[model samples]
Target: MFRVLIAVGLLAWTGLSRTATGADATDAQGEVDSARRDALLSQAQDCELRNDYADAERLLRKAAKFPADERVSAEILVRRGDCFMKRGKEHRAYELYKKAIEQYSLYIPFEGVVERLRAVAERFASGEASWFGVKERDMAIEIYELIIAKASSAKQAPADTLRLAQLQTEGDQKLEAVQTYRDLMKRYPKAPEVPEARLDLARLLLDLAKGGDGDGALARQAQHELDLYLQAFPDHSRRAEAETWEAVANERQANALYRLGEFYLRPSHSSVGAARRYLHDVVREYPSAMSADLAKITLARLDQKGIQEPEEAGQPQAAPVAAGVGHAAVVPPPIRPPDKDLTPEKAAPPRPAKTLQAADQVEKWLLPLEDLSEDTGEKAK
Candidate 1:
């Protein structure tokens, strides 16, 4: 028992000593560490030139002491990462590079390191950066957050913010993803990626509504966003798709209103005027929506005080609306009453000068088919 206690005490003391040494090395022995780190870095470079990466990495590890010049310390970390990467220890290389960004040195390969980290993030997200056959996408999320927060790669921030939100969504952290999406729009409203972010945000809101938006609030938000985006980007190539989403939002709202109206009409909660008004709200606000048609059919029954007949099977149902565009109503031809007049008549009298000329010019031809033409005519008259 005594020996075990002594062994535990010694182990604790050794751990504390190591921690203290690391803490005080920066200030108490700064000069000594600086000289030693520099020499080791030099030797590491010589080994690198000889393509002796195994030895180079060993020297770099020893050279990674506290409080060297920021540039030298950063270089040591990055060089180690490079060696590990060449040795196919990408996971280790990725960790080293991630740490190197925190040194805050201008000489650090900020752009190159950021790009490499970004690539690693993608590999992690795609399940390609696995040691035991599965990669955690949380690593990708952390890397993106670091890049954005550190501004180590400011140019990539907007796009990365969007990607981070998408990954969050896939991970089922939808609410956090929503905030991140909003952050992208607020922080970089003028970015080229903003439009896509806006579209996605609205779409995500609608998706959330599908879960449990009893009052259709999320659907309304989606509708408003789509409205503003469409106005701003009238000539956008995705305008049609955006319009479709807008229509879906509208129909969702109409559905809620319709249900509310139906609820009011139940025998337990009868309110005819309220129900009528709600149904009318749908027809007036969303005439192009499919629910508006339902509202209209329901309203007709309410007004007539009788059950509206079901649609005939032979009657053509409404065609599936085209992106929810408004359709013009076709008017039927009016009936015309038949005329009552219906008769026909009238013979004309012969002309006297023509008859006399015919008799004078052609006495023989003008003679009647019987013996006397003029005499027969006089007898007939």
Candidate 2:
């Protein structure tokens, strides 16, 4: 009786296990329906490309019914957005585009999305298509920010970060480009892209300095980065260019100092001594540079105005001490009359001064006969 009961319990357990396994398999199949939905969505996108908006919408609606994965869902949203845009429903299309971007951001292969967005931006920039404009480019930047946010965890972060910084530079968002380059350096110090990123960051900072919005600190940061690039990659293919950029960075810094000196030269706030020191620094530190030349001219002008050179200007004469109640004031002895023996020497007669008239006669005597005749006629008159 005991053996029979054990056999009956085993049979019941086996049946229950098989039932649970079948349910799990069914749930898994339901979850994996995304593959089928993705295929349908691809087909719908094809139809939409052919201007078949009605069929595209129908297929998209069907695809949306499945439990699609994030990638497929993002693609579907983008396709639906495109479909709406084709139907002249811009507001709806914008909404879907935004949703698609948000969904695409969560996917692992975010770099691929970045590539597509870059292509779109390039196409729009080249005038090849009007469908993707500044709005799409801006979305691409947003996506790049997301990728950079995950840089510490992503293997391809450095490359994507570099591309994003390049895009920022191309977009003329220089400050953003600088920050992105700095981020790349911090996150991937040993990355191969670091040298070029440093170069670019330095270049952008130099550009900011040229734009007249830069301060001493900004110029110094640029110079430091350029110096680091040169030291880090002495044999790089763009080493010469990098060196040139370094020179530019130095000039920018020197220029900042030169401008500060100029500001101090104003009569309302005259700091001639300070101005002379700054200008002298430009000449000493960057001798042949353009700013140095300007500094030289400025220094010369200051000198003409009787503003002493930096060396002499820095040394002030000692001030006279005033007489005080506690100190005795000493007075010098009165001058005695000159002694006759000290004034006894007599001088010889002085030579006569040469006048212009006498010099002209001398010149006439030294001239040749042809010139002498004219001189003689004038002299006779």
Candidate 3:
């Protein structure tokens, strides 16, 4: 038993000794690295003062390679970046700053690091041409992304998020831009950038929905987003443009509805009610859409087939009162084919000059709706 206890004590002592020796070796190596790093940094500083940034950067890069000195490595990167900045090498400085941020441990960079990153990002984002009308848009995107990712708590982070999205768009990274724009709004709901992002996103989605081969889902999304913009920023400076986009969204949706109605009306589907429902909705909900006239003509064909009008089509929308505003509301009679023996000229209601002018206006509006019957018989075939 005594022999066993002595053996265990020796084992413990040996373990302790080995641990102390390992610690001492680590300390010794750290001192060696620190000394080398300091020498490199001193030489880099001297080169910087002599306006030899090329050499200063070289020395700083060597200092950054020393092991077990993450703090100094990060410092080295910052110093190299400063040298580049002093020499007006913003792109190179941005690269070094990015590395410094990644290597950050005990060495916190000055606030200027984030500011410098933003300046570099904006350089490309602002469309500043390079020597040959070239700009590093992708680099700008990276810098902005780095700023947002590394310095998210910075006051300009939200703005950087917006700029990143814009740069992504310029770089033809639409899907990525979409996600970034969404992040901007979702992450900073109350930010001033939200409204602009919302509007721009809506426009981009709408553009995607263009062309017959485009995705209908994009159109639907645009409609919803535009609706939100209209409701949220009624008095916004860009309200008119938003309204125009909303109209386009409505037109796209109406076309979707019309096509869906056509699908239901096909012989294989033969869903009369669904056809009528979608067509009527297009005509009622989106009358200003170009497809509304198509819907009306198609509806007439269904009527001619002896299919009774759907209960929902009972109320015909009111026609315009006149060419000008401020006129009292007046629902014109249903548009029917003009009688061969009767002309609109003869059917004009006789009244005062004002009434006659109003009749002329209603007849003008009625002409287009009346002409649908002329095309209906031909189109139905």
Candidate 4:
């Protein structure tokens, strides 16, 4: 019985020692994890202060791998979002911001997020953050879009929307900018920026009309917008500029009509009278316009006799020569007979018989009579 009790006591002591050892190991691991998280957070903060967003993001991600308390995780997300914002990754930053907001909604305030977004916009607007290039500008635009979308009041909404529209214009999103400006006018007509918005919208419409393939409808619309601006703000500072644009729109409309007339005149099936009427209308309605000058010249050309249609016009007529002058005649060289005997197949010396006869004739003419008689006697014998 004594041995049995001693064995049971030893077993209990062994079990207790094993449990203690496991607990101690777990505690050490927890401490190491905590220290690692703290170190990562510190390094990330330093990188952010130095404006090294890439490294800051790297460290923040590493820190995020370890288990963190709710407050700590929320702070980490906010910091990561800021890093993304500074790096011109606004879309990603916005996602992080949303995540941080969700995490911090119960315990922490989100006013800081609003302030941060506004600060970024101000930096971009003031040219303090060098948001000139396409990438940075686009990112800024996205950030402002998010902020504007979340604007709480009428006063905040108009300014943010106006800034967004301006940024869109700078980024070559003309169509979007036009829509934004129109929306601002419709929604906040009495806003401080309404006047500027009206001016910009009119200008954008004119620009769209001036494009080579622009719609005639757009040109007419732009002219109407300019008229409204002039009527509403006669004493406005930009009234003269607005008037100039209105004239430009008028010129564009007249030019469009002139082009259409030219098109009608070009096709074989179209009527010349229709083209003439169109051109005449332009000359009458917009006499001071540049297209009016072109229309007059075209009308004069059309009025000339025997040039009623493009087909009859044929290629452009050569300029008339002087009365007495004509084209210098291009006289061809006279034809010559072919030399058959000098051809490669007939390439031989003069006839042998003729040659021999010529030689004998020369000899008879030049030789003495005695030598000739002696040569003849020898031949007879």
Best by lDDT: 1
Q: Which residue pairs in candidate 2 have backbone atoms (N, alpha carbon, C) closer than 3 angstroms, thus clashing?
A: none
Candidate 4 TM-score, true structure as reference: 0.53
lDDT tens string, model 4, 164-234? Answer: 88888877889999899988888888887776787778778777766653446677767777887888888
**TM-score-best of 1 and 4:** 1
Estimated TM-score per prediction?
A: 0.64, 0.55, 0.59, 0.53
Q: Mind giving the per-residue lDDT tens digits that candidate 2 earns over 1-381?
A: 999999999999999999999999998898678677778878887897899987897899899889866776776777776676567554565566556555566753455544444444344344444454434445456555654564446677787788778878878677888888988899899999898898888878777776574345666777788788888888998999987887777777678668867876776545566677678878988786799999999988877888753344435422322422111112222345885553326544568896667547665457576654555665778
Estimate every model's Cα lDDT from 0 to 1.
0.78, 0.70, 0.77, 0.75
**RMSD of candidates 1 onward, in order:** 24.1, 26.7, 23.7, 16.5
Better of 1 and 2 by lDDT: 1
lDDT of 4 at 113: 78
Candidate 1 residues lying further than 4 Å off, grouped into runs, are 1-56, 63-68, 86-91, 131-135, 306-381
User: What's the C-alpha lDDT at position 229 in model 1?
Assistant: 86
When summed lDDT is taken over every stretch of 10 residues in candidate 4, the lowest stretch is 324-333
Better of 3 and 4 by lDDT: 3
Per candidate, the number of residue pairs that clash is 0, 0, 0, 0
- Residue 189 displacement in candidate 3 (angstroms): 1.7
